[model samples]
Target chain A: MQKSLLIDPGKCTGCLQCELACSYDNEGVFNPAKSRIKVFNFHDQGRFVPYTCTQCDEAWCLHACPVEAITVDRASGAKVVADDICVGCKVCTIACPFGTVNYNQSTGKVMKCDLCGGDPECAKACPTGAITYVDADWTGLERMRTWAAKTDAGQRATA
Target chain B: MKYVIAGAGPAGVIAAETLRKADPEGSVLMIGDEPEPPYARMAIPYLLAGDIGEKGTYLRKSKNHYKDLRIDYLQDRVKKVSAKQREIVLDGGGRRAFDALLIATGATPIKPRVPGLDLPGVHHCWTLADARAIAKRAKKGADVVLMGAGFIGCIILESLLSRGVTLTVVEMAERMVPRMMNDKAAAMLKRWCAAKGVAVKTGTKVTKIEKSGRGLTVHLDRGKPVAASLVVVAAGVKSNVGFLDGSGVKVKQGVVVDDRLQSSAPGIFAAGDVAEGPDFSGGWSVHAIQPTAADHGRIAALNMAGHPARYKGSLAMNVLDTAGLISASFGRWDGVKGGDFAEAADKAAYRYIRLAFDGDRLIGALALGLTDHVGVIRGLIQTGVALGDWKQKLMSDPHRVMDAYLARAYA
Candidate 1:
């Protein structure tokens, strides 16, 4: 089974360590502007959502690309863009629903999270354990177990 | 069957690929005048900014991509098309026959009849070769004078700024991107550029170019002469339809194509900037943008391969990033006569949104520094959804386009 990056937005403290780690690991810089993962601040709601490419199954960015610049890494199930092939059309940036894919004006290519080739730097750098890498099949098991633990005789329900 | 495509830009390259997939056994021959591989003209700006190398401009990455598809690529210019003979006459007296033909010769920049245009240190930001020539002189702190404030000119300006050059822009129009943007939006752009230390001279024209000491003196109408080490000419581009003089193909501003992308001549089609196809507004017009070219190319190729596909029409849309400020124009952004409209702007924050309507139908939109609602405007205009109560709601506040779109589209 493939692994998935499970995110708990509630546990996120908005330290932006994931962003710093992501930028340094990939671009060799500490600039959050170049980081693939972004933490959107919702000031009124007092919440921060750590967001990146979901590596969607039927990726619109891959399909909308005039040239097959974006492809899937079967091992990690991460959608990756080939800088050599991208013509910097910026069409993929618009096609991505979550707007995770963005144009790198410096490189003239689109960039997105590639799951760090299965060992995500964001997950390791997350100080609050807000982000974690787990089996893709059971990303909700922890939450389900916690809810079950609160009910009745303390016997957890099999979910 | 042989498929002959002229022009090796985005439309031609894509047409060849689609032809191969549509007809696995069909032989594809694509002709281009450039020595390099098929490349996108849009990437030239990035190339000038040093973001990507020359090879990055290529539409297809692998050199063997066409070879692997069994598509034949040739470097030559089509001098004339003999529709009756179903063949084309090439430069240097070469001839080739085709079962069907596609014209994607794209466009060429209009060279003004001014002296010293052929001088050194003057270039047009169109081809990769031109970008190379520009990179040689557009160094940090180098004084540069750019002509024109049209769409292409603004794009080149952004890239030139990235090179850290001292820049001055001269435009004949009163504002930037006059053809695509409204006066208000254009004013915002002009102010934004000026705030970024760009010397924007709208309503100014370049009268003459003279060689000066160690640089060039660009004479402007009603202004002092501007001195610069480099001059970039982005006046405009004209369709590459001059070769079709006696081809019996109907030509206006470009090679006029029908709904199927077929030219006046049977078995001959035109795509990309060279094609004046159906427009959403009315009659025939050329969008000339990358998205339109890709769409037209695919439709033309599918029809060539015996697939019956109908193209609705090309919509007039332009999205521009002028030195960190994003601006977009959709559909009839200028607004149709007697069309109902709504607009709101915050000049201090540089945020603006104007919506046009033809009886509650979202027909057009213009926006600057207002993202997040771009998709909603596009969806509403493209789908032609009737905005019953939302029309009045939007008129009250155009920024609530997403609210209107979600409420009406989903409900």
Candidate 2:
């Protein structure tokens, strides 16, 4: 079965370990600014939401790519940007509604989450288990289970 | 089904790919005048900046991507369209019949009628060859006079600046990016560029260009003639619809298309800068932006594949990074008649915002230096959400746009 990165923002601690690990794995640095996965800190809400490419089945970046630089990796089901082919027009960055894809000024190429070719570093480094690589089909499994357990409790209390 | 796609730009490339996927056995042919592989014209600026090589400008990375996909590519320009016969005559003296035709012929650069434009060192930065020629002469400390400060002109600003050339941007308009932004925002952009040491000559026009010793002299309407090693014309582009003459296709500023992206002539569709498709603001317009081109390609291809898709109309949007100052405009940014307009500007901080609204619905937006969640403005405009009381909050304090967006979009 294909796997996907499941993220539960409620469990996030805003520690940025995911960001650090991501940057290290992809860029060989610990710079959060350079990380593909960004932890957006909502200072007013006191919440941190780690966000990256969702690897959409019909990705806007893939469709918007003029040069056909963005392609779906068969093994990972991830939209991977071929750095050599990317002309750095930043069209993909604009095309992404989630704004996950970003332009790297130094390299003049757009960068996004590649899911680490299979094992995502962000999911691996999440201390709070906020991010996990799970079965793509079962992404909603835990949420359904939680709702089912609540319903079971309601039924038991009524009985 | 046989599909013929004219112009190998973004629109044509995407349509060809989409057609291939929809009909694996269908015959598809893409024709382009440029000798090189399908390349993004927008990336030519980056090419001038020395960021990417010529290969990087190509639309597809692999050399044999089209061949692998069985999509035939022809290196020839479309000279005439015989709509009745459903055939296009190429400039190289050949006619090809097609079941469906896509006029994605894009646009041609508008070079101002200035003498000595034919001289060496003078070029239009529209193609790869142009970029190479510009790069050769646009050396460090080289005097480069860029004629026009519109969207394309502003885009190429950083590239020329990065080349370490002494640049002078001449715009006939009163301010920079006149078409994209309002007066206030344009004035701010001019100031910002001036601070960056760019000689911005606004409200000026280039009258004549004369050959000088080892350089060229540009005569303007007002200021002293600027001596330059290179004169790069970024005067903007016109639709490449010259070949569509007597084609029976409805032609306005561009090929007029219906919601299905079908032209006046059935079995023929148009996309990209060459098509005067529907606009979000309830009119037909040529939105030459890249996103529109991509969207048009997909929708047009879907219809070509007999999927019967309807285009939701193209939104006029532009996000420009002038040197470092990021400015974005969306939809009908220059307010509508009987519309409520709100704006906030911080000249010192290099920040600005202008929101246009019709009743409670946000229609357009413009921002400079306020990069954080600027997409929210686009979202608000696109969704046409009822801002309600939050509209007043935005008018009072535009910085709360993110908060307003979340409150409205999520709520």
Candidate 3:
């Protein structure tokens, strides 16, 4: 079965380990600025939210790409930007509604989450279990279980 | 089924691929006049700017992409279409019969009515061949005079500047990108370009070009003639529907296609810049942008493959980065008839926002120096979600568009 990265922002510790791992694996660097995944610190909410490409079914970046450089990695179901094919026109950068695809000035090509070809580095490097590689079809299983436990009569009586 | 696609640009290429996926047994033929493989015209500026190589402009890197897919490729221009005959005549004096025909011929650069445009140093920077010619002459410190500062011209400004050329922009419009931006926003963009060391002359027209010493002199209607080693014309483009003159296809500013992208003639369809398809703001318009082209390709291809798909409409949006300043306009940015608009501008900070609303739905937006979370503006307009009370909140604080989008769109 295909796997996808499921992120739970509440468990994120703002450590940016996922960013470091992403950059190191994909970019061969430890710079968070070069990472595919980003940990946003909400100072007002005092929360850390790790975000990256959600790999939408009808990806705007994939369609907006005039050169067809962005393609789906069938193994991970992730839309990956082929560096060799990309021409760095920055069309996909604006096309992505989530603002995940970014232009790399140093390389003159666009970069986005590739899901590490299959084994995502961000999922493995998450210290707080905030990001996990789970079955794509059942991403909301945990959230449903949490709500289901709250609705359970026995649990309500014990509380 | 025999499928023939005119213009092997992005739209044609994607449509062909999508058709191949759905109809594996159908015969696909794509025709383009260019010598090279199908390439993105949008990437030509990057090639001119030295950001990417010539090979990088191709739509697909693999040389056998089309070949492997069994899609026949032809390097011949389409001369005319005989819709009644279900065939198209090629410039090479060849004719091909088609069960279905897609007119994705895109647009051609509009040549300004001026003399000496045929001179060696003068060119239209619209095609890859044009980029190559411009690159050779637009060397460091070369005196280059660019005519027009419209959307197409502005896109090439930074690329021209990146070559270290002494550039001067002459526009007939009142300001830069007049069609896409309001007077205030256009004025701000002009200032930003001027600060980037570009000589911008708005409300000016190039009257003539005369040969000079290893260069040329461009005569303007308002100012003194400027000396230039090269003259690059970015005036505008007209839809490439010349072949459709007697093909029974309805024509406006572009080929008039219906909600299904089919033309007046049966079995004939249009897409990309050539097709004046449905508009998001409630009409038909030719949104010549790349996103619209791609969208049209997929939707038209699905219909061609016997999958009925209704195109909602193409949104008219443009996000431009002039030098370093980012400016964007979406939908009816100038505000519709009897529509309400809220605006805020910090001229000193080079930041501006103008949100237009029709009733309770956000319809359009104009933004400058607000790149972060700008996509939300598109989301709000495209979704057409009723803002209700949040409309008032957005009017008071235009910067809270992201918050408004999340709340309203999800709610």
TM-score of each: 0.80, 0.89, 0.90
Q: DockQ of each candidate's interface versus the true one?
A: 0.07, 0.16, 0.19
Q: For residues B1-411, write the lDDT of model 2, one tens digit per residue.
A: 999999899999988988887788899999999889999888788778877778777877777899999999999999999889999998899999999999999998997787777888889989888988899999999999999999999999989999999999999999899998889999899999999999999999998999888889999999799999999999999998988989988899999999889999999999999999988788899999888888788788878888777776777877787897878888887888899888899999889988888998888888888654454565566567688988898889877776675455442
Q: Is the docking of candidate 1 incorrect, acceptable, medium or high quality?
A: incorrect
- Per-residue alpha-carbon lDDT of candidate 1 for residues B1-411, written as tens digits (9 for 90 to 100): 789999998889878988998899999999999888887778788788877777777787776999999989999999999999999999968899998899999999999887788889999988878988999999999999998889899888888999999999999999899987888989999999999999999999898899988999999987899999999999999999999999999999999998889999999999989999988667899878776787688788888877866666776776677887777777887788889889999999999989999989888889888644254465567667789988998999888776575455532
True contacts kept of 3: 0.29
Full candidate order by TM-score, most accurate first:
3, 2, 1
Candidate 1 vs candidate 2, TM-score winner: 2
Report, for every candidate in turn, its global Cα lDDT versus the true structure. 0.81, 0.83, 0.83
Better of 1 and 2 by lDDT: 2
**How far out, in Å, is residue B163 in model 2?**
1.9
Residue-pair clashes per prediction, in order, are 0, 1, 0
Q: State the fnat of candidate 2 relative to the true structure.
A: 0.19
Candidate 2 lDDT: 0.83
Model 1 chain B scores worst on lDDT over the 10 consecutive residues at B370-379
Comparing 1 with 2 on DockQ, the higher-scoring candidate is 2
- Kindly provide the TM-score of model 2 when superposed on the true structure, using C-alpha atoms: 0.89
Inter-residue clash pairs, candidate 1: none
Error of 1 at B401 (Å): 2.3
Q: Which sections of candidate 3 miss by over 4 Å?
A: A9-50, A103-109, A121-130, A141-159
